[model samples]
Target: MNVPMLTTDFLDRGVELYDDVTGVIADDGTEYTYAEFGERVDRLSNALLDMGLEQGDKVALVSGNTHYFLETQFAVQQLGMVFVPINYRLIADEYEYILNDCDAKVVVADHAYADEIQPIRESVPADTFVGYGADRIEGDWHEYEDVLQSGAPESPERPDIAEDDDATINYTSGTTGDPKGVVRTHRTEHVHALILAHHMELVDDDTYLWTLPMFHCNGWGHTYAVTGLGATHVCQRAFDAADTFATIREHDVSYLCGAPTVINRLIEEYERNEPETTGDRPVRITTAGSPPPKAQIEQVEDQFGWKLIQIYGLTETAPLITTSNSNRRIAQTDRAADLKVRQGSATLSTQIRVVDEDGEDVPQDDETMGEVVVKGNQVMDRYLNKPEITHDAFNERVEGWFHTGDVATVDEDGMIQIKDRRKDIIITGGENVSSIEVEDTLYDHPDVQKAAVVGTPDDDLGEKVTAIVVEKDDADLTAAEIEQFARERMANYKIPRRIEFEDDLPETATGKVQKYEIREEYWEGESRRI
Candidate 1:
């Protein structure tokens, strides 16, 4: 008999087998057993049901690495509702677009971020609003605790959810347009979580730290994998270098994931403060969002005595298709750091190929750059409401394969290393910023006539968003003023870090700005363009 896969299976197993175990530790030091966690999820499910949310309805959550974020995910999925986790860093307008785009019936936001949504609540489709800390929020919102108390602390009646039913809608930044909702089904998320758990080497006795944002692809699917494995989740509201170290010691955290920037920050903190690195247990960290430099990897493994794993993928691909955590590969080489820095070969059952413009596989000599394409169950079902774009994404370069739009080179051993991005998206500090979006904001400035945005290599952040602009005739504009203007319009991460005045931008015969040529000047001696 074939069994239908569902995301709720993770939490169900935790509740059944690990009822007495400490399942989650809230950011505020509140610990909940697996049974308590399951009941809370049930309460949330029943609460949403009482609020008129039916199966397939979308419930958007805007929060940091909090327990409620995890609870809401399992709670929503268990009842066959779809969960939409929004980036807490986004502005009200950006949230407005996502909340409307997903057609969320309910929105649950953390108090720290509820202000951003309160102003645009009327503009969104969500009829009900719940705040995690309602007392601190300046709006008429239902308190999360109150909402939970209003519903029964028992599992809500589940609908007949199929394996292909929509489970989550994660909004990813577009290359040249608005954010696209990457639709993931129950089967895709369930399989991805299982694959992630196996590759990350999660165990029942392990404690997972929440240094990474939970909203980021459901904490890169760790919310399920870690829970399903009966591991303890130590929540941290946000990633602070000092707090991360303290929490690891406090909770005996054995595993965590973060971007290269997080690794750099930890290194900086370690050098400055020399805090205790780990508890009795050895710690393992997985870095992605951008390749960690060799020095960072070495410092993490050698100095901190922690194993570092590098992974590669996008929001559209369940965010983990490849990982550089092969123990056998490292055993053969003295230069283990070198291998760890490269986004290694495909994970179990995931097929990855680097192809030239003609869709033919490129030579795996590690020097020839090609666009990376992939096919796997973890891949997203489609971009919500964007059929044409979704079709082109899978059909381009190679038919039936999702084009990653990432330029990479594969070594003889099939380890893929990313070199550049084919799309005009700047991934600065693990956040995607669209060059076109920033340019449009720059153009709104009366003094700005032409602007080109590019990603410049940074030692800390994998890439820094840089802007080159030509001011209007006789119009003087300072970089600070332009940055301030951008700050008011877009998210802080999307704001250009470095702005340069230019006489004119280089263009091709078709009058399209030659961004590749413009970016070459900034990445003069860098080994990689991204």
Candidate 2:
């Protein structure tokens, strides 16, 4: 009666029930049915086994969104080998640090990025280096296709994997110093997918566009969720507005996930092309990272006629704890635009609490800010080789609750609204200002496009509110005019004292504006970052 939950369960379900259905749409325009994809996974599994990779051994992969990365996920999980998915956007040094940190047994990288790995080839513990889908591979690099072809297509013997067996070691983009690997067991990964599938309404007929990077929290664990439900995966190697819209139209995509940056790009593209909706069916765009502005959300639904399911989480929580799905009642009323801006309620099987510094629950007034802590089966087991950090993550003040490091509020309706990250909150003249609040106001301006707000060191005010603005083409917006716009809408202390126009702002791979990067220049001589 007690069967084990496993990441491999997703693929097994698809193979048994939907073998004939198209499962994957590769970036190269190649298609594979569930049956065909299963066979490929089988081949890769056998090849890994044949090469002496056993359960618990780490297999590292570095690449963009590609079929090879997806296949490696299933194969590595099936054999009970730990999968280390490195962020491709990281530098060669960063990549080397991860490889050495994890002591990867085998390293698989895209051929295009082979140069990055070459410098630290000898230093990494990985014995075998596999390359996929590129010319001019190193002489020692094993071809990904060759390995798949070397083994028989028959399914390999399943390893004795349990629900709690080690699964993935995801490296977070380091904000402090070295990146730490967040370890998730098979159970966590499996349930995280199911929870996501439930909230996103993933069905067999739905097709998901791969706008989010596969490397990011395993595409927010949708890689397993969509695949398990037998939904078609329309993979795009990179996130491009033209290609994304085209993929949606071509594949009749019903669902997708992205951050605010991706949504903004699509909005820009949609305006230029005026592409038709994805038929009469509802398309869900699940956004995470920084919350979207109300105007942006309204424009997405009004102009593009697609639904937005905004979510919030981190790599530590298997990346999903809260989601704001489109509610018909709210959408029917004038409050729909306002609701779109909130992070919504706790997801199914997840417990969320907004607690003050003392670990006491914050009042549900939607104004009292506190840190968001979450508890659920989907939370990661631990940070690999990071006992101290893991211990600190589950702060003892609130036992069993994982501290999220985000400052937010809970409204009367149980909606969790994020004010800002704990570090991003700007303190000017002894008053705290939510960067998100100012950014939302900036988004309201007709001429402004993407915006980011950060605190700049000031002798008089301690720190002054600074704004970085990327304006719409041909729009002559000045710092004074922008400051004037904010003054009318918010407190004078909260309004940006300085504004700088730029072609674009620097963003992390997942679309989050890197405020720390922006602060480097301003705080160069200061001993303290704050």
Candidate 3:
């Protein structure tokens, strides 16, 4: 008999098997068992039910890595209500667009970020406002604790949720235009969590630390996987190098996820003041958002004694389709770092192909670059209210597979290495250059702290390869020296013809270099060709 696979199955299993086990450790160090956590979720569901919320309604949350954020996810989803988690780093105008776009009926925000929503509260469609710390917030909001107290702790009446029912809507960064809501169903998220749990080797005895934001693809789907496995969650309010190390020791955190920017901060902190890296348990970190430098990965493993795993995907794809965590392949080669650096082979039941413009799969040469396309259960159902855009995204280049705008190459072992973003690829006079290739070469230089390569408008070469670099402290580097260093490493066309030094490069909330923002500065007058 085929039963509907719902996201609520995770929490149901957790409560049944590990009711007395510690389920969550809040940011402020408060601990709650699975029984207590399940009751709180039921209470919040009843509260929303009393507020006139029904099935197919939307509940938006703006919170940090807190216990309530975890509670809200299950609470709203259990009632067949769609959960919308907004990026707390976004501004008022962005929040306004999202709230109105989703037609959120109730908005639950953290005290620290409630002000951003307060200014535009009246303009949005939301009727009820709830704050985690309502006393500190200026707006007229119901306290989160009071709302839970108002409802009964028993299970609220649940709707007949199907496998295809909408589970959540995660918004893209919208660097180019308005952020698009990626609508995912219960089956997509449920399957993705199972795949992730298997690939990450998650176990009930593991302790997970929340260094990544909960809003980011539902904390990369860890909110479900970690809880479903009956593991402990130690939430950190915000990412701090000192706090990360201390928390790892204090809670014996076994696993966590972060972007490359987070890894850089930890490396810098380790260099400045050496700290104990782990507690009694071994530690493992998963990095994504951008390809991390080899040096950083080595430093994390060798210096910090932590395992680093690289994953690849976007918000639209349930945030995880590939991971470079193969022990079998790594053991066969002495160059484990090289294999670890690549966005390794596809995860179980996922099909990944690097194809040329003609929609034909490229050879596994590891040199010929092509766009990465994928077909998997984890892919989103559609972009909400954007049918035309969704059709174009899926139909473009290939018929059914989702086109991942990332240009990459597949090795003989089917290991895919991302070259550059399709828009970020630099086209000189006649040849195409990968900006990531150039940046990776620059990172090899000891003096180079950070680098971003962009194509600048040029009359002769169509577009000249340019580099914006951040040098190490106390290092006085010259543009000529950098060019000479590039000459020894890469081809003449791939080398940055123009180099500019900067104190620091602009980064996104996830720590990716804002290349589009950097491109806007250089291509002020003329439109960039690529």
Question: Which candidate wins on lDDT?
Answer: 3
Off by over 4 Å in 2: 175-177, 326-333
Q: Give per-residue CA lDDT, model 2, range 432-470, as digits (tens).
A: 999999999999998888999999999888899999999
- Count of clashing residue pairs in every prediction: 0, 0, 0
Considering TM-score, which of the candidate structures 2 and 3 is the better prediction for this target?
3
Q: Which scores greater on TM-score, model 1 or model 2?
A: 2
Q: Each candidate: what lDDT?
A: 0.87, 0.87, 0.91
State the lDDT of candidate 1 residue by residue for 1-530, as single tens digits: 99999998999899999999999999999999999999999998898888888888999999888989988999899888899998887789989989988999999999999999999988888889999989999979999999988889867888899999999998874433467999999999999999999898989999999988887778888998999989999999988999999999988889988876577568768977999999999999988775555767778889999999888988888889999899999999999987887889899879999999899999989877789999999999999999999999999989999999888889999999876566666888987675755775786676766778898999888898999988866788999999999999999999999999998887421123567777778889988767
What is the model-wide C-alpha lDDT for candidate 2? 0.87
lDDT ranking, best first: 3, 2, 1
Task: Let me know the TM-score candidate 3 reaches against the reference structure.
Answer: 0.98
CA lDDT of 197 in candidate 3? 95
TM-score, cand. 1:
0.82
Top candidate by TM-score: 3
